[model samples]
Target chain A: MNKKNNLLQCPNPQTECKECPIRKMALFRDVPEDDLGWMQEFRNSQYLLPAREILFRQGETAHTLYTLFDGWLIIFKILDNGKRQILRFLLPGDFFGFQVNSIGPTGGYLHSSLALMDSTLCAFPTTQLRLMMEKQPQLAIRLAEMEMHDMNLCQHHLIGTGRKNAQERIAFLLLELFHRVRLQKQNDYDESSNSIIFPLTQEDIGDAVGLTSAHVNRTLREMEKKGWTQCQGKYLTIRNEEALSKTGQFDPRIIISKPLI
Target chain B: MNKKNNLLQCPNPQTECKECPIRKMALFRDVPEDDLGWMQEFRNSQYLLPAREILFRQGETAHTLYTLFDGWLIIFKILDNGKRQILRFLLPGDFFGFQVNSIGPTGGYLHSSLALMDSTLCAFPTTQLRLMMEKQPQLAIRLAEMEMHDMNLCQHHLIGTGRKNAQERIAFLLLELFHRVRLQKQNDYDESSNSIIFPLTQEDIGDAVGLTSAHVNRTLREMEKKGWTQCQGKYLTIRNEEALSKTGQFDPRIIISKPLI
Candidate 1:
């Protein structure tokens, strides 16, 4: 059970650990029930954020870690000239803002993360996490595995961003999100929906894929004409998965399901 | 202390763990001497690889992890069309080939590694490392930190690959390697040496930067004409670090000196 926070206009101040909605997909799913119970005490609050709200800013001193219990988020960096690069997308059950100040007493985030849609996150104090990790080596292992999994995903994104053309890149991104959503939902995912629910704008796709928004729009239109997919607004329906896969030269094998703890 | 293995034609089979050339720069530098001593047993074998030798191949089963004792190595992935992309470079004191098989029983190397020069490596069986990790939880933390450091590097590389121009990309990479070499060899590095020893060919640079050899050549020549640096066979001297940094928009802060473990 969660207590509603009246002052902050937060939906819940505390969320029951075992009954959490994303418990099945969360990082601690593999963690033992006893260990998970320990985390229940550490999760002090849950914050509900509106779309475009920055969860953390680049160069901001990171003092907490958050679990994205629901909704979409993107971690990005802005250059001195004001150009932005989307580093990685954070899905439900993902961890964010865990940059530990290991080298010195003060450290800041290398990238900024903003909520792509209305989102809920369970916040944990970094100090408590470090203490819990020291007490439970297995917890530390899970955290390490999470970072490894993140690294693997970033490497895969590198291939698409560096080598693939605009069309292939967009196709690859769509397919990746599709598979990720499928994994999170499993058989419960509604096939009748026909299209994947994506909250990202074309500019978001362009930023993520390292292409200009104009180029992304042109590529999506070309794919639409080819009958491979229908990309309208925030929804994409893959009419021909085979063609998209072939065009992107995408291999799902590169994606690590989970990191080995 | 370690015993010399007579059967293997190794240069040094029994290097005292404390006196290890990379002991100071190695990941385990933070580890207590007693805990660090445990690694002496794993340093049972050493392999010297000549340039162009493939240490491991993509899709091949990964059985061991190696620590580079000397010389250079590059981890790369080759596309279906045989176009290669350099994933990361391995230097002295760097760990290589720690592939976590989380999905299923059969797991392969995500990328292939080739020796860029005659390199000496101390090899350790992955199984033993895993077992050691179980016994020494701290070792697992260090390993995870290494992977995070790697991911940060890849993300920075991604920015260059996706957003930067050909000349900027080349400048950025040179600055990166120069800094890395400087970090690895702090005071012992000879002041008499004017240029950084770069064993990479222009083609190698091209693969690393997501460019063609011709493009890399043109970029290098352009930088040369501007009196930026002199690029000779296997050597690159930064004649003007300030100009190169400005052109590349290089920030050493992006690099993780050591990941927050």
Candidate 2:
């Protein structure tokens, strides 16, 4: 409801939970079809966030949980020193907004989220989550599974920032987003092509991987010079997947898996 | 089951679940007293991991999840370049061993865990987790809550490694562990004293906070010179909690909260 955040409420009307295109991969993946009517009732609304707009700010009281219905988003924390750390890149069907100090007095969001592109998100009131889970136990299991997946991604980023060099980190981020985009069957990904629409600026890449924008630029140039990969005009293409994967120590199998939901 | 991992089975004939000292902070924290009987039946066994012993290695098939009943442990990953990243430190009542590539062919553990000192753990078959949760709905909710807590910590560490300088990172780690140890009411944390039995070496600190052992050494020495903290023998004491917290940007309230279970 924060107007300056550029959140447009009920964009294109609410999509029925039972007919959700990404239902197979969404939070309700395991819910029995007969149980979906309640889920529809539980969902507060759908909102469209314009590209580069703030979805939620860090330390804001968290009132709802979200499922990214479409487009990309980044969850990040800005440190006391004003440096930003992008925690995770969320794709369609990804559930988020649970990163709060639930037992604390403030119960604020631990990090802020921003739309990498125009995005749509389905919202569910936080207070009713427990009741919903009690009614549909599978939802709890699905949530646990989703959290595990996100935790893995977080750990991977920790490893990158803590141990990997600039080139390796950048390569890892690119390949990760590439694999995620392709695997998710996003419209931007073509079956016959290795390129995908990449929306992150060099600064965003730097923030995500703990590098300076200059460092990211230089490293990316080196990677491109090696004929391993290329990023131009908001498109990233893997020219030699084997070499890039080797450089990044990326194992596609670790990232490509069935939707836990 | 791996002999080289130094796991001792059936340590002390398994404490009765109904009388578990740390039950209030554990996976079954919210389960009704009547339901604990089923949990006791579900627990596969108890194991003791000796000081500096590997509990489980990365890439091993993950069969069991663990709940730490005593002592200290750390979960970490070794990079292709042989650099290590300490992901999380586990205290008594902490649950772990869920970091695995669940949907992959290998179905392997994503990282390795090691006991900092002699530690006890309760094991449950990973395969039966869903079955257990299905029978006990509160278990699923508790698991989600626990995962959310763990995710928050992971995000914090990611922020530290990605944004904070060496001193800030070290301070954060120390304050975090100190608060956690004291708040958990561990035997080592005397109610009248500010010290706790610290087990991590400088190298371990380095791995956890993305610094070198020498750098960690210098930072600790500096903090000591300032009369802010001390780590002597196996004990770490906070002499100036306020100063250290300010330097670390630590909010004890964020880490000190009622157990979600």
> Which candidate number maximizes DockQ?
2
Segments in model 2 whose C-alpha atoms lie over 4 Å from true places: A1-5, A11-13, A101-105, A186-189, A257-261, B1-5, B11-13, B101-105, B186-189, B257-261
Residue by residue across B9-115, what tens digits does model 2's lDDT show? 96465798889988877888889999889878879888888899998787777788889999999998888899999998999888887643222336777788898
True-structure RMSD for candidate 2: 2.5
Summing lDDT over every window of 10 consecutive residues in candidate 2 chain B, give the lowest-scoring window: B98-107
Which residue pairs collide in model 2, if any? none
Model 1, chain A: how large is the TM-score?
A: 0.89
Q: Chain B, TM-score, each prediction?
A: 0.90, 0.93
Instruction: Give me the runs in candidate 1 sitting further than 4 Å from their true place.
Output: A1-9, A100-106, A191-194, A259-261, B1-9, B100-106, B191-194, B259-261
CA-lDDT, candidates in order: 0.74, 0.82
Question: For all the predictions, what are the DockQ values?
Answer: 0.38, 0.57
Tens digit of per-residue lDDT, candidate 1, span B122-219 = 88776686677677777767776676667778888887787788988899999899888877777789865658889999999999988999999998
Tell me how far the alpha carbon of residue B135 in candidate 1 is from the true structure, in angstroms, after superposition. Answer: 0.7
Per-prediction TM-score: 0.91, 0.94
